[model samples]
Target: MSQNGPKMNEFEASTATEIRMDASRSTSVFLTIYSDFASAEKVWRRFEEYADCYAFQSFDFLDVWYRNIGHRSGVEMQLVVAWGAAAKPLMILPLGIETSKLGRKLVWLGNEVNDYNAPILAPNFGDCVAEGDFSRLWSDILDTLPAHDYVELMRQPKMVGHQINPFTELGLKLNASGTHMTQMSEDFDTYYDEKRTSKAKRQFRSRRKQLNEIGETKYVHPNKVEDIHASIDNLVALKSEALKAIGAPDFLAQPGYLDFYKELSAQSLNEGIGHVSHLEVGGEYAAGNWGLVFKGRFYYLLASYNGPKFGRYAPGLQALVELMRWASEKKATLFDFTIGDEGYKAEWCEIHEDLYDHIQARSLRGVVAQSLTNGFLLAKRTIKQNPKLWALFTKLRAKLANHRDFG
Candidate 1:
C-alpha cells in the first residue's frame, strides 16, 4: 500500500446514477489493458492493500478464482488498470473475456463465485477521473481490446470504496434482487438479542431447536486440511442435491465450479479470506456453508443442507444462523447475505442494497444475445416477485425434475 495514498474519506462521494461532469482542474487517468495477470502484480497488490474495495476484488481471491474457475470455463484475463500522471496507480478493474456460441462477452473475474464485482480504486480515483472523462476513457479501453460482442457486468454495488461506483453512471438496471446485510455486535448471543426483535429471536431459536432435536448438533469450522476437504466434499454434495432437486441447473456438479469451491475454501482457511464450515446432527454432517470474510465484512456466498434428511428441520436456515453467530464471534461488523430476495435473508438483514447490471451490445449478435438474456431474466423476476406464481413454479419444477421432498 502506498504510504501517502488518499484515505477513503478523502475521495469525493459520487452516485452511480449521476454523472460528474465537472471540468475543474484536477488529475486525469490513462488506461492500460493487460491480458496477463502477473504484469501488473506489484501495483495491483499495493492498491488492493488499501483500496476502497470489498474482498471480492482481493488479489489472491480473484487470482485463484481465475485459475480454477474462469480459465477452466475458457475465460481469459483482460484486467484494466487506470494510471495517473507520474505513473501512480489509480484503479484496477479485474475483468475477463468469456466466449460463447452467441457472442464474446466481457465480464469481471471471479464472475461465478464472488458476490460483488468491482474495481479496486485508490482513494484519489474520483479526483483522477471525472465521470465524463472516465466514460470516454472506458470507450477507448474497449476499442483497444480484442473485439467483444457485448459486455455483461452484473451484481455491482452502488458504492465502491468511499466514493460512488463510477459504473453507476452507466445507469442502473436494478437487479431483481438486492444485497442484504446486518450489523454485528461484540458478542454473538448479545448481537442475536440486540439485533433481532423478540419475535425474530424466538423464530431463530425455534429453528436451532429443530436441529438440536435431530441430535447432538454443533457448528463446526475445521482447522485441518483433511477436515476442510471433507467439509467441502459434503458441501458440494449437499448443495448439488438441493439445486438439482429444484430443477435448477446443477452448476456445482461441473468440474470447474466444484474445484473452484474446494480450492478457494482450503486456500482461505487460515488467511481469513474464505471460510468453509458445517453443521452436524448426531455427529454427521447435515448442513454445509461457504463464507468469505473481506476487510471486516462477512459474505454468506454458498450454503446448503441434506434437504431430504434435514430440510424439515430447516438445516439450510439454521446453518445461516450459525454462520451469523460465528461471524459475530470473529468481530465481523456486517453480515452480507449478498444479492438475493430469499425470505430467510429478509428475516435478518436490516440493510437491503439494490444492485445493478450493465449490458451493452457492440454488434448484431450481441443485440440478439442481450435481448434473450434480458427476456429470460425478466421472466425469472416476474415469477420471483409473485408469491403464488413462485410457489406454482417451484411445484411444477419439482414434479418435472423428479425431486425428492425434504419433508
Candidate 2:
C-alpha cells in the first residue's frame, strides 16, 4: 500500500462488509453509484471547491467529455460519489464501463484522452478513511459496480494538488514513464534561463529568427468562435496526416474524438478549462495546438505541425515558448508537458513524475485478462526503459510501415 493510503490495520482485501460506519463516530461514509453524471453532478461540483484533484477531473471538463464523447460512444457512466457524516460530500470516482476485447471493463471517465485518472478527494478524505475501514468501503463500491471482467486504473499519480492521491495504493504497478513538467517562476525569462543553457537559448532564438525571416511570425490564440473551430480542425487534420505518414492508428479517426476536443475547446477554452492556439508563419498555419489551463497550471495536450517542412524552424517549440511566456504572464505556476517521454519535452521539463497502473481481476475471465494485460505492460515497461530496445523497435516499426506501403 502507498504510505499515503488509509491505515491498513484490521484491513483484509474484500473482507470488510460495513458500508456505513456509526454516525456517532463521525467517520461514517456512504457510496452511491450513478449511471449518468446528471444524477451526481451537484455533489461532484461541491467537492471540487475543496477537493484535491487535477484539472482533468474538474466537473466541467468531464461533463463536456460526457456530452460529446461518452454519450456518443455509448460509454456508460459509473460515476461514484461518497459522502461523510451528515451526508457531506467527500469524493467522486469518475468511472465508466466499456466493452473491451476481453469483456466489459470498468475504467475512469475520459480515460481514452486523459493523461491521468484519479478520484477527486475532499480535504478531509484521508482522515475519514483512516477513521473508517477504507477496505470495506472500497469493497462495497466495487461490489456495487456493474459487471466487468476486470478494472484498469492507470496513469495515476501519488500526489494531486499537493495532497495524497488515494488511488496510488490501487495502481500498484509502477509505470516505466511519467508526466513531465517545469515549475515556473514569476518571471518567465528567469525560469527559461534556468531550464536552458545560454547556447540552447541562442539556438532557440535563431530558430525563431529564421522562421521570422520566412514571414511575419505570429503566435495566434484564437478566441473568436470561427477561428477556434478552424484552428482546431486544421490541427486535427495535421495530426491525422502525421499519424498516417508514420503508419500509426490515428485516434482522431475514433468516434467523437474530434467532437470532444472541438466542442470542449469552443465552449470551455475561454472559461480557462481549455485553450486553443497556434503559430503562423507568413500568414499561413505552421503549428496548431490545444491545451488546458486550470488552477494555475498549463497542461500541454494535442499539438501538431504542418510537417518537417514547417518543422525546420521548430514552430511547435516556438509556440510552446510563447505558451510558457503566456502562462507566466497569467501567473501560472507550472507548465505541464503531461505524460510523454519525448525528447522535446526533456529539453524543458524540470521534473518527471512517476505514474502507476492498477489492474485487478474479479472473475475467471478477468484473471486471464489480467495475466495477458500484465504481460503486455511488462513488455512495454522493458522497451520504454531501455534506450537501445526503443531505438530498435522504432526502426522495426518504420520498416514494417514502409513494407505495408505506409512510408
Best by TM-score: 2
Instruction: Residues 125-182, candidate 2: write the lDDT tens digits.
Output: 8877863355566767888777788888888987877667766545389886889998
Off by over 4 Å in 2: 1-18, 21-26, 269-272
TM-score of 2: 0.91
Q: Report the C-alpha lDDT of model 1 over 79-133, residue by residue, as the tens digit.
A: 7766665766677888888999889998888877767877788888887676656
TM-score of 1: 0.87
In model 2, pairs of residues that clash are: none
